[model samples]
Target: MALKPSQPLRLFAEHLREQRINLTERWMKAVFNDADLTESDRLTYEQLADHVPAILEELCSALEDQDLDQVEPSIERNAKLHGRLRWKQGYRIDELVRELDLLRQVLLGAIFGYAEQYPAFTRRHEERARYFIDEAISFVTLTSIREVMTERDRKIDEYTGRLERANHELLLKQKLVGELYESRMQLTRSVVHDLRNFLNVFSMALQMIARAPARTDTALALANRQVGDMKTLVDELVEYSIVLGDTNAFATEAIDLRALFDELVAACVPTVEAKGLRLVQRFDRELGTVVSNRLKLKQIALNLLSNAAKYTKVGEVEFDMHVCGESQWCLRVSDTGVGIGAADQERVFKEFERANHEDVPGVGLGLAIVRELCRTLHGDLRFASHEGEGTTFEIIFPLRLDTDG
Candidate 1:
């Protein structure tokens, strides 16, 4: 007997069941082509499409029989499975929903493909086919939402517990911290105050040794240089401790920019030579000193030079000083080194941050200290660098030294 003509919805639904394999294949291909969905390490076809065939049979059966009881339970089970699996795979709900939409498109394209084979599929047939697919979407998404909400509630509960514990511990510790902070402040001030007096003694002893008749040329020069460097370090420690407690701690004095630059260059030479790198110092003779904390200025200059020498391996490190306006001067340190990447440049000034992966050592505190010291002096610090090219740092500030040139 010849086949009887039927409604288009029933016919298309039957066609979908018959072409379920083709539909699944097309859906998988569509998913693989999607860059967002093709992360197989996280979401493989086996995980995403395991229930596709059953999904098609049940959904098409619903369209054919007009009964949802047969399909709803299966779709709900599969939807819950997908929700848990995708969450484990690190998929956000938005990405999962996106792929589901793509699956719908691919399946609809399969329906259009069937239209060419069966003349009974009109646009009305497309609408009916969509109604069945739409029902499937609603069921799957409802179950998915339920599962996700369940997971979210569990996470919220766990995090709430952790937060409650942390708050309790913090409350207990704050009292002890309050007591220790005062004691620490007192001890630090006492220690640093005593240390400053020793630096003054060290200065006197170096001068005495430099004038002693028994002192050899080489030994006297070495002792004087070592004492100067040690004084710089000691003064730095004392001022740093004082500044940490009070930003207005360091005393300002009459300093000559020319003579200070010469002394700093001499102090930094041994460190540069140890690294087997050339250190060039250029200064404008007219850039007379300004009234500033001489020790703090020396610390900033030496810190920059040390960083330049630390990062640059083969190429020369240069320090340039010049008078900008009548009362402004610039100190620039440039290095031919492995320059900072763009991602790290902004954060390099943050405390304890390294700009590159190179084996360059240090706790990443230098730039942060440079920035803090610059703020103390009301100076402008800026940098320009390319990844492979060199980096240049310029510290520009008003003159604060004696007018005696």
Candidate 2:
């Protein structure tokens, strides 16, 4: 009842596969704690592991008998016999091979003894064992091929996932491009309309001057003033477009807040006086120079001040330059003016959107431009207002004090 030494090498390997499967499954479960492994996968490995003993026994017997007949029952021989094994199967190799070598020697000794004791009966059993061993060797070869196929399939899956993600991003980019193109067309139409109106007015002013030569002086001056206003509007529109398009629009520069505020107040003092509004200025000496885009920051401040002046009929317009939160410079502008409504506050920053007001005059781009400029400088703008009481706009910017000489 012993295996023989004359068994095929195929049987020796099958015996190893059986022992390896069991040891691997046990070790892997202990180490991994069974993370994400499906029941089917587990069952497959378990079945393979359980069959390890039979596989190894056959291998040993085949090797001893030198017939290779027992090799047919190996894991590789029958394609439909088992499901896919988990990656953990590789762990069982050492132990299985060790046990298999021992079995081979034992069976080999049995074979020599059987041949010596009963040469007549040995031939028939040897032939059967040889057939089994041959099948088992084929099965073992198939298992290795299966492992290779599994690896290839895994790589393919990874590639497919990456391709899907890339396609999603590409679609988003295409949508954005379409939206931008439409916005550009709208902007172009607006520019052309404004230009046509400006030219028409210029033509009418020229005709009026030609008709009355004596009154031409006054008419020309008024016409020139209108043209100047038109030019200012055109400049603002162009600047806004450039700022929005360029990612690197804000060039950092060191500026003194006190000096900047003084200059802004001086520039707007004539308008403030014309409106009969009191201007109050307060500067904190401790607030030092901050590094930012000086022009953009000035544009924001000027817009807020102009908005305040436009809305206010009589009260005081207050400007305060001070340190707000920790290491942040803040410019607060308060005006006792006809303030913004709660319903319209959120939409004020959108392009070409103005609150419903009878007295105010603008294309509704001032606040939008202000917000964009603030964003470019890595700052934020916020406001609080009441319809009849007053309005306050706050600009908060991180203080990056220049240290390099």
Candidate 3:
């Protein structure tokens, strides 16, 4: 059932109709002056006043007829459009509510002003106008907020879907990397295994030829040395492959630094003396035990010592160990070898890279392996060298290795 308005209510509605343009102008002025409605400032007059005139017409019709049902459809449509436009203009929900409340206040103030101007419009007409304005603004505020929330939810879903797809792609790439690494390890093992079998046959043939009557000792010796160099290369390839594939390879235990140095020096002495170079050692007797990967430390030390002995012609190769800090230690290998040139120093640690020494027998996995092993053991390797003088390689290791690291 539709409720009818009194004659004064109809007159008030007609008065509002006459002042619709003025009312809209007043509302626009309020929005522009409001600090909280700053988003309206970015809009042109048409954009800021979007659907407001239509909303005012609906409000007047509902006031005249006193039938909210008749005006609801148009009010809802206009209010939804206003909400979406304000959202597009970067209005916050609070700002939207504040702007609409201002509209309600403007209409009520106009009603009170009209009642004061005319003797026929009493307090009853003013109260009726207030009731209708409250009803319409409530509906508009609800509908507008629902639209803004719907748009916000839709955007949230869109961003969530993008994040999910990105995570899936990252997982796929990680799986591909794992598969490629395994394939490489398999290939390296197969190739190294076959090469070792062939090398064994060549080594046996060289031994047999050395025993023959027509054997040239110099040529046989050279052949034997070449065979030995090939074996060393194969061994380095295996070690490099293992280090690359296994991150959990550093199985740690407590090691006596003095004992480890003594053993390493003893092993390196035979090779250093064979090259007619003196082997020198300096150890800190007070050097106590350290918790680290003994095998990796041994490999790094041996590689540096061997390189020192292999390059030095007349001068000594020094192996030194000392306490570098309160909880750190340094193992330094220095030699009067043909030192690396400044240009080649940067490329020295790269795989299969040798520093300006083509005639030197090396497949160049030595420093590369050393670097990887140093990192695995939580150590830092640094070197200083001059062209004619020598190279000194120092590795600083923590006194106590952290297993988790």
Candidate 4:
């Protein structure tokens, strides 16, 4: 066989092919630290750093051609993707430009450092390599700027549309101020009324505790219950604001659902037994590991189970789980307690409204919180209730196979 030309170009290309993955990882770590980039609430590393592999491969291909012209496709794709992500994450144009400048420097440094080890490489080869990367970086910068501007224009268009819609609504409602003012006043009065009711409960419970001696324990327990109610009111207020303000504040991880359920059941058993009720767990299928925000899931489960235990005075409270479908799982809690009436079904979901308006110590925020949480999990929160019979709350969390993403 005839001997093929074993030039520096072949050596460089081989290095890229062999070291592409390891090099990409190193590049990402460097970029992550060097740029002070916060990884959360932004595009993941896979999304953010997707273009690096293609760029490396293209550079290897370019070595054979003795030019950088063939690298345009990868560069353009990279620029657009990066620009889109930066725009989403609120990165300034200058910051993105600086990052690209640093990336180009780092990549060139690695390539040049490798070249320096080869005694056969000449200054002319070094200059050619520098020129090639410099041109490529310039192209990347231009494409990035163009894509960012495009995204900016898109956001502006969306804002304009929203404003126009608001203006249209205003024009329609201009003559309806009397109705709007009356509604606002009613809402204000309702809020004030609810606040006063809660305050009255607290104040009366404290008075009873102070006056009674023979019934001291009972009065103290009532007072403590009122304190818990006040704390729940405050917690619900905070949680409602947080859940409404930014649903993306938390992250999810893979966890064994069965393990979590076991913990919950064990914790709830004491309370259920104390209430003279039986706690029953029914597993329809094996609960494999699932991807979810553990704290939030715990909150959801705790609320449901606690509510079930709290309400069920006579019969057993049951917790059920099963694989509902190919990608969905269902968790349900049922209590044979004082159930919800049809009249209050819609009212209960409203802020500060309770199903057991007369006897329940809660501010009616649990179901509301559960509903908001279920929405975040890409799941549903629903219940079936018959007054004086029983109630069941089912929450379904769909499987996300792409955990660690």
Candidate 5:
């Protein structure tokens, strides 16, 4: 069997030592001295270096073992230990230990092979034997270096991939944090405002009763109106909290764009007549359908229409509906009202963000709810306005295909 070819044994042992030295140098001189190293990273590297001596002893013992069968088993056991040190007992230590392990295996294998082959020569030929061992060790060392470098590069690439994924997860977490904070702030404002309104109504009623022990019908009726305002304020606060709370609870369904505007106009007709304002619904019936939460969609439309009525003294609020493309439908509500300033247009969609309007009565949660509702439905809400001219708000949704439920 040609003595089972001693080349593999020599090659494995040479790489084992080269890898060990290279790793120890990187850790002791490079990684340990770097100021940027985290405390945790430094400690892991320290632990790895402390455990390397025992592993090197095993490599040396396997070289002298006379039984070739036992040599293979010893190499296998040590190789596994080396892999764990390089990859598992933590990253900082594993990095160096892995290299060391590779060098040990390479050098030990070369040493054992030369010993086995030279025992047959009777004459003293130390120089010739040294030359053979040196050539074999050099070739094996170069090959081991190339293999270690390839593995090192792979580890670096893996580290980079993990970093990018962690960064992306952090960004998502930040966005969720902002949403949760906003919800908490809204809850606080709701409680405070409701308490103030309740106190004001109770005080007014008590004063009216005190002045007239046997209350006149007209005085009682006037007190009752103040009580009604308190109720309306309470209802608005509750509704705002409910809509903003989970934003994702609404059930989605297919809706017709033109028909949705028509229903919205009908519901607001009574409010429009009382305010002496005209609402015109101009839409293309062919605009067709979209998939969304119907009740939530209606709420968004009613909020916009009510806002328009609140701001307009006598001008008209028109709904212009059309299909912009094959996969989208555009629904715009344009009003010739007090209008909005350029800066205020963006702020209007933020919670508690009210514009400067002395005539309009609001705590400023309507449009904020509208924007939130739009996002939940996978649509977009945007506005363009010129102060004192008019404001136009556009909403777009994905078209309902024939395959939609």
Candidate 6:
């Protein structure tokens, strides 16, 4: 059975059909002028008006028949297509709903204008027209929001998967590099250990030859000194290898600052005096106990003091210990020695790097080890120097070591 058209609805439908083009134009103008609908600015006139004309045709048919079900398929198809296009054009869900609402307002105004022209158009016809427009706009808004959210979720998942794969590949490469480095360090330690053993045997032989009743004392003394220098180099290499391999090698304990300084100065006295240089020591009266890695602290102090004694000729090597702040302390080793030049100072903390003085008895691992150990103990090493004016190396350490490091 065919449903008969209602006279008022048929008249309203006819009016909407005649004003369709003008209504669409008005809707476009409203969208462009709306601050919230800025996404439409990049779209062309046809692109922005896509499927709207079809929607208006279906709306007119549904109004005239007074049966929305007959025109539902066409209406739904056009509305969904418009939604997807808006999503691709970067329209937010709110903007999409707002534009549709604006269209509804424009059509309602046309409806009122038609009602005023025909005396038979009553409140019942206006209400029916409003209900159909509201239902259509509601369906379009929900459909568009669903499509936009679906696309958004899919893109998020894709980007997250890519990031995970990249991080996994990075971890694998890092593990491989670490394994190679460890293998090289192990081989170096083995070779250096063997060389130290040979040097020790050679030193023993030179000592025995010197004791012989031969006039080779000067030559034997020089040979022994050369062996000693080689032994020192090997020892530094071993120390550097150990520090590199095990970051947590040192344990913290309460150490007496005055006692530690006294021990270090006593050890360096003979070397400084041999060069006709004085060893000066000064301790602040408030020197107290500190909780730190004792062995590492001793190592840093000894390296600085030894470097000072090795380079100075006649001036004093001063070892000063003072309270830097309430929670920290400072050790300053200043020397009147052949100081490092500006060019060499930058590489002073780099492995196997030496200063301009090639005659110095070192393989240049001293300062590098000192710096690594300083950082491991939550401390810092800094220096100031000028060529021929000598250098001052200062290290500041926290009173208490942080175990987390």
List TM-score per model, in order: 0.41, 0.59, 0.55, 0.50, 0.63, 0.57
* Poorest lDDT segment (10 consecutive residues) of candidate 5: 120-129
Against the true structure, whose lDDT is highest? 3
Q: Write model 3 residue lDDT over 137-213, tens digit each, in one string.
A: 99999999988988888888999999999999999999989977875675566557646755776666677676774
**By TM-score: ranked, best first:** 5, 2, 6, 3, 4, 1
Q: What's the lDDT for candidate 2? A: 0.66
Per-residue error for 176 in candidate 5, Å, reads 5.2
Ranking by lDDT: 3, 6, 4, 1, 2, 5
Global fold similarity of model 3 (TM-score): 0.55
Clashing pairs in 4: none
Evaluated at residue 60, the lDDT of candidate 5 is 34
Give stretches of model 2 more than 4 Å off: 1-161, 210-222, 245-254, 282-286, 341-347, 350-352, 356-364, 384-391, 401-405
Off by over 4 Å in 1: 1-243, 401-405
Best of the two (3, 5) by TM-score: 5
Off-target runs (Cα >4 Å) in candidate 5 are 1-139, 142-179, 212-222, 247-250, 401-405
User: Could you give the C-alpha RMSD of every candidate to the true structure, in order shown?
Assistant: 18.9, 11.5, 13.1, 18.1, 11.2, 13.0
List candidate 6 stretches off by more than 4 Å. 1-219
Backbone atom clashes (below 3 Å) for every candidate: 6, 35, 0, 0, 27, 0
Candidate achieving higher lDDT, 1 or 5: 1
Scored by Cα lDDT, where does model 4 land? Answer: 0.75
lDDT of 6 at 158: 89
